[model samples]
Target: MSENTINAVTRRHWVLIACMLSMFMAAIEVTIVATAMPTIITELGGFSQFGWVFSIYLLTQAVTVPIYGRLADMWGRKRVFFIGAGLFLLGSILCGFASSMGWLILFRAFQGLGAGAIMPLTSTIIADVYPPKERAGVQGWLSSVWGVAAIVGPLTGAWLVQHFNWALVFWVNVPIGIISMLLLVRFFPESREKTDRRINFTGSCWLMLTVTALLTALLQAESLGYWTLVLSAVALLAGWGLLRHERYSGEPLFPLAIWRTRTLLAGNVGNLLIGAAMMGISAFLPTWIQGVSGGTPLQAGSALAMMSIGWPLASTLSGRLMQHTSYRFTAQLGSLLLIAGTAMLLILHRESPVWYAGLSAFVIGTGMGMTSTTFLIAVQNTAQFEIRGICTASVMFSRMLGSALGTALMGAVLNYNLMLRLPQYSDPVQQVMSPAGREQLKPANLDLMLTEIAHSLHWVFVVSLIIAFGSLLMSRLVPVQKPH
Candidate 1:
C-alpha cells in the first residue's frame, strides 16, 4: 500500500480504538455501580428508592440515544461525541459528591445523557472508517471491550468501596472520561452528512414525551396502578402522533426510510429482547449472590465477572470464525446458546453450588457476545453508508428500551416476591434476608420467610427463560448468508 494509504489506515485504527475505549468505559460504569449499590444505599439510606438510581439513568440514556444519532447525521459525529464525553465527566464528578440518594439519581441521569452518544457513534464511526468485509472483525474487538469492562468495573468498584469510599466508584470515571475526551478531540475525524435539514423541535418533543410516558408506565406499573393505565394510554397516543410526524415531517428525528429494510427491523426486534434479558441478568446476579448464596460483596463481584469473561472470549473467537462463516449462522448459534443458558438458570436455587451459577452466567455471556456483535454487523452491512448512523442508533435505542423495561419489571418482580415472602418469616430468619435489611427484620418468627425468598427467585428465572426464547424466535427472522 502507498505511504499515504498506510497513514490513513493507522489514523482510522487509532480513532476506532479511542472510541471503543470510551464506549467500554461507559458500559462498565453502568455495571460497576451494582457491586457498590448495597453500600451506597446504606450510606444514603434510600433502600426504598434504590431502583431509581439505575432506572432514571437508563431512561434518560434511552431517550437521548436516537436524538444524538439523528443529530450526528445533521451536525457531526466528533462534535456530538466530545459534548457527550464532557457531560459524562461532569455528571460523574457531581455523582461523587452527592449527599443524598435523590441527588445521586439526578446526577446519574446526566451521566446517562452523556452515555447516550457513546455506543451508537462508536459503531457509526467504525462503519465510516472500515469497509463491510473488514467491519465484522473490528466490531467484535469493540464487543470484547464490554466484556473487559464488565470484569474490571466490579472488581475495581469493590476494591474502592472496601479501601476508600463508595463515592470513589463514581469519582473514578472522571479521569477516564477526561482522557477519552482528549483523545477523541485529538484523533477522531469529523464526519457528517451535509444537509440543509431544519431541526424538528416539535417532532423531537413528541418523541421524547412518547418514550417518557411509555417508560414511566412500564417502570411504575406495579406501584401506581391507575397512573400506569393513564400513562400507557397517553404514551400510545403520543407515539402515534410521533409516527405521523416522522412520516410527514421534512426532517424527522429518525428517517422513516430506514425502517423499510427488513434486516434493520428484525435486528432491532432481536436486540430489544436480548437487551432485556442481558440487563435483567446483570442487575439480579449480584443481588442473588449476596442474598441467596450469602457471598461477600467481593465474591458477588467476582461471580458477575464470569459473564464479562465469557462474552469477550466468545466475541474474539467469533470474529475469527466469521471470516469462515456467515453472520446469520453465527447469530443463530449464539441465540441458541443464550436460550440454553437461560434455560439452565432454572436449575439455580438458594442451595445450589456457586460454581453452577457462575457456569450458567458464562454460557449466557458467550451467547450474548456472539449474537449482539453479529447482528450489529449484519444491520450495518445492509444499510447505505449515509444512513448507517441512524440505523445503528435505532438498534441501540431498542436495546436501551429493552434494558429500561427489563430492569423495571425485574425490580417489581423481586420486590413483589420479597414482600409476599417476608411476612411469613419469623424475625430471626428475616434478619438474614438481606445484609442491608438484616437489622430491620431481626424478629424471631421471620426465619422461615427468609428461606422462601430463595424460591421466589425461581419465578424470576422462569420469566428470564421466556425472554430468552423470545430472542431466539426473533433471531430466526435474520436472513442466512454465506461468508463473502
Candidate 2:
C-alpha cells in the first residue's frame, strides 16, 4: 500500500473512535437519567407522568432509526450524523430548561429522534471503513464504551443531582456533543454515494404508524383494555400493508432479500428480545433497589455499576474468543449467561445481600456484552458488502424497538402489581401510601410492593430467558461461511 493509503486507513480508525465517543454520550445519557429520575420527577412535580419521560424518547427513537439508516444510505452517513448530533444537543438544552414534566417528555422525544440516528449510523460508518475480520475488534471497542458509560452515567448522574441539580445531567451532554462534532468535522473524511433514488414516503409513514400502534398497544395494555386491541389490530394491518408495499416497491426501506435469509431473521428476533430484557432491567432495577433495599439514590446507582463492570470485560474477552472459536458458540454462551442472570433475579428479595444483587447484575451484563456485539458481527457476516449498512441498521432497529416495548410494558406491569397487592394491606398501610401517593409509600409498604414488583420482574426475566434460549437456537441458522 502507498503512504497515502496508510494515512487514509489511520484517519479512518480515528474517525471510528470519535464516532464511538459520541455514541457513548448518547447511550450514557439514556441510563444516567435512571438514577436521577426520582429526583427529577420530584423536583418537576409530575410523578404520575414519569413513564412518559422515558417512553416518548424511546418511541420516537424507535420510529426514526430505520428512516435515518435508510437516509444515511441514500444521502451520506457523515451529513446525517451531524444533523442528528445537532438535534440531540438542541433537545438536551431544552430538556435542561424544561419547566414541567410534559415539556420534559416532549423534549425527550426530540432527543430520541436525534439519538435514533446516531447509533445505527455509527455502526454503519464502522462497517464502511473496516473489513469483516477486523470489524469484531472495532465493535468490541465500541461495546466497551457502552459498559463504561453505564457505570459512569449513573454514578455521575447521582453525584450531580445530589450536589447540583437534575438539569446538570442534560447539560453535561453539551460539551461532549460539541467536542464530538468538532472532531468529526476536522478529522473525518467526507464521503457520499450519489443515488437518484427517491424517498419511500408512503412506506415510511406506514412503517412509523405500525411501530407507533404496536408500541402504544404494549404501553397501554394494562390501562385502556379495548384500545390495546384496537391499536394491535392497527399495527397488524399496517405491518401487513408495509410488507406488501416493500415487496412491490422498486426501492424498499429494507430489502426483502435480507429477511429471506433465515440467519438474519432469527438473529434479529433474538436481538429484539434481548434488547427488551436489557432495557427492562436497566430501567426498573434502580427503582427496585430504592423500593426494596432502603437505598438512597447513590446506593441504588452503585448496584447497577456492577453491570458496567461485567459488560465491558466480557465484550473484550468475547472479541478475543471470536478469533479462536465460532461466533455461534460464543453467542450461545452469552445467551445462556443471560438466562442464568435473569433467573437468579427471580429469587431476589429485599433481604438479599447487596453482593448477590451485584452478582446477578454482573452476569446479566456479561450476557449482554457477548450477545450484542456477536449479533452485529453475525449480521455483517451474513450480508453482502453493499447492503451491510442496511443489515446492521436493521439489527439495531430491532433492539431499539425491543427496548421501547420493554420499558413501557415493564412500567405498566410494575404499576399494576403494586395496585393489585396494595389492597391487601391494612388502613395504616394505605395511610402510609397516601402522602406521595404510591411514591411515598412507607419502607415496609414499599418492601411489600417490591416483592410483588419482583414477581412482575420475574415474568420479564422469564420472557428474557425464553428470548435468550431462542437466540441460542437461532445461532445454528447463521451460515458458517462469511459473506463476501
Task: Give the per-residue lDDT of model 2 (tens digit) for 84-158.
Answer: 888988999999999999899999999988988888888777766766676777787877888778778877988
Estimate the TM-score of every prediction: 0.85, 0.85
User: What C-alpha lDDT do the candidate models reach, one value each?
Assistant: 0.77, 0.76
Off by over 4 Å in 2: 1-8, 35-44, 161-166, 220-226, 283-300, 346-351, 407-460, 481-484
Error of 1 at 55 (Å): 2.5
Clash count (model 2, backbone only): 0
User: Which one wins on TM-score?
Assistant: 1
